[model samples]
Target: MTALSEYERLEAIGLWRADPQAQRRDVILSLGDASLVISDAKAGSALAHWSLPAMIRCNPGERPAIYAPSDEPGETVELDDEVMIAAIEKVHTIIESHRPHPGRLRSFLIGGVVLCVGAVALFWLPGALVDHAARITPQAKRVEIGRKLLTELSKMAGQPCTSPSGDQALAALSKRLPGHDTIVVLPEALMGARLLPGKLAVIGRNAIEGPDTPEVVAGYLIATEDAAAGQSPLKRMLGDLGPSAALRLLTTGNLPDSGITTYAEQLLRQEPTPPPTDGLLRAFRSAGVSSTPFAYALDPTGETVLGLIEADPFKGQPSPRPVLADAQWVALQDICTGR
Candidate 1:
C-alpha cells in the first residue's frame, strides 16, 4: 500500500467495459489506498471497485494497457494514461514482495521452535539428547541429510563417478549388502569405505582399481556396513554437529547447513575407523566373500592383517556365488577411469 501513498486519489480517464458483449464507455478511474475505483463519467457515481492486489495486466509491454480484476474474461479496463499503468505495476510489486510464500512461513515457524528447544538443550545432557534425536529421526529426513553431506563431500573429493554399465554393476553389488541401496564410488580423496545415513556406502577408487577382484570391493562394503551397524551413522553425524545443532534437529527437524558442510570436509581429511576384525570377518563369511584379497588390500606386507588371511572365510573352498559377472566386474573397475 506504501507504493500507492504518493498517488493517493489520483484520477484518470479510461474506457471501461463491464462485459465483453457490452459497449465500452468513458469512465473516471480513481486510485484508492488498496483499490481502483471506477466511476460513471456522467453521473459521478462509483460503478465498480477492483482490489489492487488482484488486478491482472492482460497485455504486458503494450501501450494503452488493458487490465482485469482477476481472470474473468468478461470485464476489463483499458487505460492509455502512462502514469496510471506505472502506478498499478508498482503497487502490485509492493504487494507481492510483502506476501508470504507458501511453505516459507511454516519453515520460519519450525526454525523458531528449534531455536527454543536448542536453548533448553544447551543446558541438558548433550549425549543423551543426541541419542534420542537420532533414534526418533525419520528415514526420509536421514536420506535428505545424507544427500547434503554427499554434496559437501563432492566439493572436496570431486563428484561421484557414474557410467551406464558401471551403475548396473554397482546396483548388483549393493544387493549383497542387506538394506544398502547406494554405493558411491569416489575417484579420489577418501581413504577407504564409510557408511552414510540412509543405508548409503561410499568407497574410494582404491577399492575398485589395481589387481583387486570384485570380492575385494564387496569385502570393503561389508566392512563399512558392519562398522555402521556397531555405531549408527545418524548418531555419529549428530554428535559431530554438536549438542545445540542436534537439539535443533530434534525439535525442528533440521540442522544448520554450515555444520553438515564442515563435517563433510572433515570426513574427507580423516580416515574412517575400522570395525572389529571378528565382526568384519563374520560379515565377509556371511556374504561368502574371501577375506584374503581385502586383507592384502589393507596392508600389502600382510603383517598387520595376518588374522584376516589366516581366518579366510572362503579359503580352500569355492565362493558360494560370484560377486559380479566378468563383464560387470570389468565395468566396475573402470567406473572411475573415464568419468
Candidate 2:
C-alpha cells in the first residue's frame, strides 16, 4: 500500500492513491459538517464514518476512542484528537498488515499447523497408538489388495525344476545357501524366489531349470535369504501388515486367518521380493559367489543387473559340487509341476 503523491491531484473530493496498481481510491471529506465518511467508489459501501469536532475535544486527560459496528445508518461517533489519530494510525497499520508482502505466507502455514496440532492435542491422541498400529497390522495387508495382488498369488504353473545334473548340483547349491535354515524348491512355473517370515526360501524348480548352472541357483537363494534375514523376516512381515495389524500381532502373537492365507498364496507363487541391492551385494561378497547369475535371474534387463554381471566375484572360481547332482536337479525340477 502507498500514499498519494504530492503532485498527483484527485478531483473526487478526497480520494487518495493506495498503491501503484491504482492511482486513487474513492473517499469523502466534509469540513463543515464536523464529520467524515469513507465509502466505496460508488458510495455503495461505507467503510468508515468519523466525527471531527468531538474528536478534537480535549478535557485534560484524554484517551483514544474506538468504534464498534453501527446499529443504524449514518451513526455518529465522538473522539478526542489523540483518540482520532490513534484510531487512524491503527487503521493504517491494519491496512499495511493486510497488504501483499513477500514471505507472509508463513503466517498462514503456521496457523494451519497450529490448528492441526490443536485438533490433535484437543482429542486424546493415544501415545501408544502408533506403536500398537505397527503391532496389529496384518502381514497380508502389507501387500496391496485385489486378486494376484502379489500378496495373494498362491499357485504357479510351469515345468518342474529339472535336475541340473544330480545330487552334486544340489550339494553345490546347498553350499551356496549353507546358512539358511530351510530350503524349499517349487516348480519353475512358480516364477521367482520368495523368502517367508521364517528362514525359508521358496524357489521354483526353474531356478535350476534351464541352462543356468547349480551355482547360479545357489547365488539367487543365498542372496534372497540374506536379504530376508538382514531385514529380519518378522520385522519385514510386521512392517508390511500396517500399524493396526502389526499392533495386534505384537499383542496376540498372531494374525487373522485371512491375513495368513492372503500372504500364503504369495509365498506359494514365489513372486520375488525385491532384494536390497546393497544387501545383496554384501551377501554375495560374504558368500563368495558372483552376483551376476542371481541378478540375471531376477532381471535379465541389461539396465537392472548390469553391475552384478560386470563385478562377479566368483567369476572364475571353481565352485563346489552340489549335494543334489545334475541328475537330482532333473528329478526335483518337475516335482511340483507334474503333480
TM-score of 2: 0.48
| Cα lDDT tens digits for candidate 1, 1-339 | 444667887889999999989999999999988889999999999989999989999999997899999997878999999888889899988898898797998999999999989876676679888889889999999888888888888888889999999999999988866767798988878867777888777888888887447877877777777776666788888888888888899788998989988888877776766778888888888888888888888888999998888988887244678888889989999898886
RMSD of 2: 12.6
Candidate 2 residue 284 Cα shift, in angstroms, is: 2.3
TM-score of each model, in listed order: 0.61, 0.48
In model 2, the runs with Cα more than 4 Å from the true position are: 1-176, 226-229, 264-281, 295-306, 320-330
Tens-digit lDDT string for candidate 2 (11-123)? 12334333334455545432223234555556557656554322322222444333222333323233334433443444445556767876668888888999999878555
Report the number of clashing residue pairs per model.
0, 60
Clash count (model 2, backbone only)? 60
